[model samples]
Target: MARKASLSGFPEWLPAERVVEQHVLDTLRRTFELHGFANIETRAVETRAQLLRKGEIDKEVYGLSRLSAEDDKNDPNALALHFDLTVPFARYVVENAGHLAFPFRRYQMQKVWRGERPQDGRFREFTQADIDVVGDGTLPFSYDVELALTIADALSALPIGDFCLRVNNRKLAEGFYRGLGLEDPDAVLRAIDKLEKIGDEAVAKILVEEVGATADQAAAALALAKIRTLDTSFVEEVRALGVEHELLDTGLDELSQVIAAASKRAPGKVMADLSIARGLDYYTGTVYETVLVGHESLGSICSGGRYESLASKGKKNYPGVGLSIGVTRLVSRILAEELVTAARSVPSVVYVTLAHDDSWHEAQDVASALRERGIACEVASSAEKFGKQIKYADRRGIPFVWFTHDDGTHEVKDIRSGEQVSADPASWAPPASDLHNTVA
Candidate 1:
């Protein structure tokens, strides 16, 4: 017989764990809508050309084809699974530009696929919750500030412990690199983006060799990455670096404004950290990376940036800023670390016990009455003893079991506290806390 085996990259959760995940997703959705972002879902697959618009993620895209296809490459319209929501959303914006209102704000939660190798918190298939604000031409920088606060609102509502959102501007990093006399600052930004992963020394080597930076220049670039501040003080820190450029000055002021604004509202939640050079090449302005309090090694649980130039089609270019929560990665980390759990595995709030097989219909009737009142419940499959019936509820962490007495009246058993009380199927209800399974 063929043995059952689990795939390494694709993750499946038990019913209880799924409860926790769903709660997190629901929290994110509610928070996003409360902030005025409308819901939008794009297709899961995009043309290879549309996905390749970003230019850097082509290799990581999963191409779609059929086994019977003779020449997939020559199709000119080959489909590929979207590696992230941004690209598909961009394509959607361009395609729907005629109907969509200007300065559209939307939230999308969906699965995305990537062909990259997976380990720890990373996966080949994952879910992402993205909120974006796109404009017809130039978008307000205030939207950037708003997105930061909105993201904070969403994350703070979850069980993920205290987190620090390290904010930066691509202009800041690139301008600093340019001010340091690096001919290819974009390339340097790409290299130093590896600073957190490969360390300063290795990043410096890439700068000095591939990016054509001298030893001192590389050191200065590394020095900039070290500047981290909880408030507007990051302004002086960059000034202290002594690297000056028109773009550098502009970036510094812009970043300082965002940090100051965020601080005034959500104190201690947002900060300036120069090391947060998001790996994506599309980011043109403010970028963010979030690290949980003690789980720093787990990497950013959430991250995003501003892309001013996207899906440019014949005089129309979509510009936007956005954030995405790595849903699967965040849930996986919380589960693996035991950060939170569901109260129970089953959704049933109460289980109806059967006195005998002849009473099955009555038991089901009770269950149906509870359902009509918005209470979830299930009827016992067999007419077992009351003790055995209560044991069934106990094993599943179900809080209550219903019993019908000889008088045709009903009694509810609280399995947890050994408490029993008379109840009516029409009027009786479980406590508010037992209405549904919860994550804590």
Candidate 2:
């Protein structure tokens, strides 16, 4: 069973819960590696200047200072806990530009800290799994499609049942708003981004009153936001609005390429959602937001986009496309709803039982032999009765118990089946499914 955290926004999982989290991390690592993405880890702290380089998140940043240090004496450029992985990665790329290859492909999975209100899906400290492909000066558009497919494949491998990888192009939304005679497309995008939180009526009011959009223009913008399709049909849907701009044409073409490829390749897993404006102005091209089928209220469990100028060094720019998975958020929901279960709490597959006081040495020998054969087993702490030892193993979720007899013979019992058979320590092994703890 899991317990509540004494500290708000900080979660601590029980042993069984931890098993599920570990399995999730391990599975993501495997999938990323299979796609030839090398793993890298950044420091947990970054200078304030570095953290705020991309956006002004001062309120959400936790400043670090020595216990004896006074506020006035602290360095003007003091360090603080990193709130996201992208900023540190950008700084790392620029500092190490000479040593890295062009089109660097890396994946980072580490804890990030944010100073925000504690809520059901929000946490102060959580793990994020990120995969990025960066290039020197120029990054091809195909990478955007590749990232969508990669994320789709990774998520599909998990036990999370169904999901939709919503793809959109910033150019499409901005250009559409401009064609509709809206001066501030960013403000319109911001308003549309809140459509899910605040319903369409509220969004329309914001568009008309705040964004300076006429009623007809607001209606037209809302119509575009309502467009969603699994195929390239969204092109005609957007065109039906009778809006046109050079940028809009470019965005429509770019988005069509992505939806065409992703929809065909990852059928039923990808959709072209025009309302996904991403809220971030830096995303120049494609943006992605992912949601579990039945858990739409949880918002996007994963999100990211292409930033053409995230990092730069002496006039050269590093453009990249990436996505980050909210690991802790997903795991929390899984545990809270019992979406999946762990095969065992512990990794031990066999429990080596003791027959007598002198059997310690024999038990050790058997354990050593089994370990040499790549089996995991633990010897009894004392020469307890066989029943007591078996009970201990059962409590720990161990499947098999091995007993050494006075006649120098060995027998292993499957506790779940009550089947005991003669066996050799050197060769005995459990079924493949029982070899390790699994989460499903």
Candidate 3:
């Protein structure tokens, strides 16, 4: 017999870990809904051409086809797993523009596939939670600030630790680069994006040697990258560089506006960081990347940016700004470090015990009653010793178990506290607060 090969990038977790994932998802969905973002889902597979519209993401696309299909192996046609929710969302907005409300706010949580080497905190298959808002004609500059603030608020609501929402303007970056006489401004932005990874020395080498920046220019750019401020003063600090370029000034103004607006809405949540040059090619205005304060080495757990035009239908233009939380990455690190946990084994509310073969139907009735009240319930598979059944519930982390006695009385056991109380099955209710277990 051959030993089974373990796949490198595909991650699977135990039931306990899955509970944590579910809790995270539930929290996100609730927060998004509370803020009036409608839910939307797009197909997992899209045409290859559509996926490759943005050149940077093309290499990471996981193209797929029928395994048994015999014809046309050389000329692969349209079919690839979605790499992120934003692209498909752009397609969705363009396809369904007429039906949607202007300045549409949407929340989409889904699995995205990427064909990249997996490593710690990086996976080929993972889930993302994306929230975006697109206006019909032209999005207001205010929408830009609101989008960033809302995402920062969402992250702050999570069980995760303090996170810094790093904000930058692509226009600002472009202006600074173009001011420096760089023809391909994206090349310089790409180099700056590596500031966290390659350090100041290596990034300076790339900027000066590879990108043809002057030694003085490289040092100045590195100083800009190192510029970090908690408020809008970052704009003033960058201006001190005295790049002598109109575009850089305009970029500075835009960054200043965004930071001021976000601060008014969510004080101390947003920070101005000149180094946050998100590598995506489509972003034309503001870009966002959030880092956990103590876990800065873990990288950005949430990131997104603004695009000038999401649709190129040869007609109307659709501009939008959005952010996505890497739910899988956040959950993976939290679970690995034991930083968070699920309160219960299952999401069920009550577990009804089958006391004996003759009492099975009564157990079903009890479960059905709870279900009628919107409680999730489960009945034991068969009558077993009370101790054994309680042990089963304990193993599953069931908080409460209901059992019937020979005297025609019913009892509900608070398994965690080991407290049992006699009660009428039809009238008994779990305390409102005890209905759901919460993480400690």
Candidate 4:
């Protein structure tokens, strides 16, 4: 029989890699909770109409129905797996509006599905960590800057390498396109979004051929897209493009304000990048993308933008802004590059060994004592020789091994440093820092 194939886009990791994943998830949960952001989860599926409201993303929606059941055929357009967290979140807020708190601050970390061709760093199934705040009435403009800065701080706290947050505003791009005498401003914005994939020359060609731009005008627009800087210097640089656009100026101002606010809290983390035109129809204000230093080619590991009027059920208007970190991508890159490694396999702080049948119960007692003290411990099951037991613990990456003797004595051994010390099981304690795996 042929070997069962591993699904293309569904990625799985071994025990050690899973340790890294757990660490990342734990860190995010702890940090978000510390900052007072409440956590919530919504179902993975939404109505087809809701998913298709933003027409551009329709290609990635994974529509679902019971394959074996005949009763579901009548509801053809009923359910589809969500492509991103933002849309589902909007639907969630509207459904539970009466029960939620105003200015509701929420953080959701879960798997989102997309029916797209799988590639490096892009998966059909992946995890996204999103943070957003929605108000009962009008959301404060300051929350825009606040959300961006909070996400910046969260990403900065991760063990991954240094990252730069590239921010831009939609109004600025729309204004510039409108000022250029383009009839459809959104068309121009969409063209600019392709700057990373299609080079400037191709984009210029498209602008002239498809969007009806003069050669000089197209060249100037392309030049503006190419202009990027680490700080607010991007403002002065884009202005030099000589494109008389009011929207560009407004965008520049918003970018400046957000950068100023973020810097005040965590200096030198946010930068204005004129090239970051996130290709999404919903983004109406500031946008964000994070790139790891020296690994720019890996593409954006975290991205989101502000959206206005997302909560309209064809009537009510609810605008909100937020960001999401591609946790799977970030962790994958770190592991691929060997940037971080787990210090141990299991969660046990110490493994109590059984030398013989007579000492097995004693070993269990010692492990129990350790567990009572808030330490994780596991007693070896087999009554293996002392040398073999120690080797077993070392092979599993169990850092500290406690060998029990019939005389109520124990020997603690550190596998990594090859150090062993005699101790009394009732009174011994591993240093607080050694209780958990330390990233090296």
Specify the highest-TM-score model's number.
2
How displaced is residue 146 in candidate 4, in Å? 1.6
Against the hidden reference, what TM-scores do the models get?
0.96, 0.97, 0.93, 0.92
In model 4, which regions exceed 4 Å deviation? Answer: 1-5, 70-77, 238-246
Clashing pairs in 2: none
| Cα lDDT, all candidates | 0.87, 0.90, 0.82, 0.80
Q: 248 in model 3: Cα distance from truth in Å? A: 2.2
Name the 10 consecutive residues with the lowest summed lDDT in model 2: 68-77
Sort the predicted structures by TM-score, highest score first: 2, 1, 3, 4
Model 2 lDDT at residue 433 = 90
Clashes of 2: 0
The residue ranges of model 2 lying beyond 4 angstroms of the native Cα positions read 72-76
Write the number of the candidate with greater lDDT, choosing between 1 and 4: 1
| Candidates sorted by lDDT, best first | 2, 1, 3, 4
Q: Per-residue lDDT for 1-440 in model 3, tens only?
A: 11111786677777667777877888889888888899999999988877776666677887687788654323446588999998899999989988999889999999999988887668888999999989876888777787887787788778887888999888787787777777778888999999888799999899888999988878877888888777787876777777667777777787788788877887887888989998888888889999888888788899988887886466688888899999988988888777777677677767788877888888888888787876777889988888888888888777788987787788889988889998775677777765765554
TM-score winner between 1 and 4, please give it.
1
What is the alpha-carbon lDDT of model 2 when measured against the actual structure?
0.90
Candidate 4 residue lDDT tens string, 21-121: 88888888888887789999999988887777768777787778788855442354688889888988999999888798778889999999988887767
> Which scores higher on TM-score, 1 or 2?
2
Candidate 1 lDDT over residue span 53-109, tens digit each: 557867788888887876475454898889999888888888898998979999999
